[model samples]
Target: MTLNAAPRGLYFDDFEIGQEIVTSARTITLTDIVNFACLSGDFNEVHTNFEYCKTTAAGEPIAHGPLVYAVAAGLQYATGVNDGTLLALLQIDGWKMLSSVKHGDTIRLHSRVLEKKESSKGDRGVVTFLRQIIKHDGTTAQEMTAKYLYRRRPKA
Candidate 1:
């Protein structure tokens, strides 16, 4: 990912329904898989054992699904659109892992604002988005509906 010199974040009031964001690409590597495996303690054969994978549908070791999901979130954050305006991740719904991403696959995040709602007290709001992880070959490897709490724009 290319580093941003000035990362701008959008407040709750700035998001509009139907708005889309496409982030820069990042390539998956064996080191990423190994690090994730060590961090998550999920050394599943599908992700850590290549020899064991030849017997499975993947035919070779693949990155963990959750690792890809995490990467997608990282890609979104790297865009700097939510630098400080984002308060917290409220929820994730309808998450799906449609395909497997392997080492060397370049991926990017596609995020679309689905809806936004103001808090009852007007101090914060929630934004719902449809986020997808798209691989270099144009395949959507994973997708989910993510709801995030965001602070409202500060009044002058």
Candidate 2:
């Protein structure tokens, strides 16, 4: 498959170690923060309180770290690289939030395949990806390495 084409969910053989995928951007909004707060029950003042956040370093409410991580995870799927071929998310490593994500910030994901190893049974492979959640101004807000299991395409 071509690099830029929409993958029909890649199989184990489709991933290359250095292949990179960029996803569409999503703007963070107050409603998103509020909804995430309600769903996650994370009501920290820095994330949910406008007046209270004015006294903090950011001077405005910031999105929750896990929320940003969740968005990044969704963005990876938006790329459609493993839409139908993914078996499971095996692990996450070295996840870090380097900068605060404030409301109105547009974010996108940049992911690169880091490693791939065939399973012992040979029906699937584990692929490791390094992902970055970047803001509109090119600031990296979060990063992590994720490992996913992908099925191998059946041989005819």
TM-score of each: 0.93, 0.93
Supply the global lDDT for candidate 2.
Answer: 0.91
Residue pairs clashing in model 1 are none
Candidate 2 off by > 4 Å: 1-7
Encode model 1's per-residue lDDT on 72-140: one tens digit a residue. 888888888889788899999999999899999999999999999999979899999999999999999
The TM-score of candidate 1 is 0.93
- Candidate 2, residue 97: the lDDT equals 90
lDDT of 2 at 43: 94
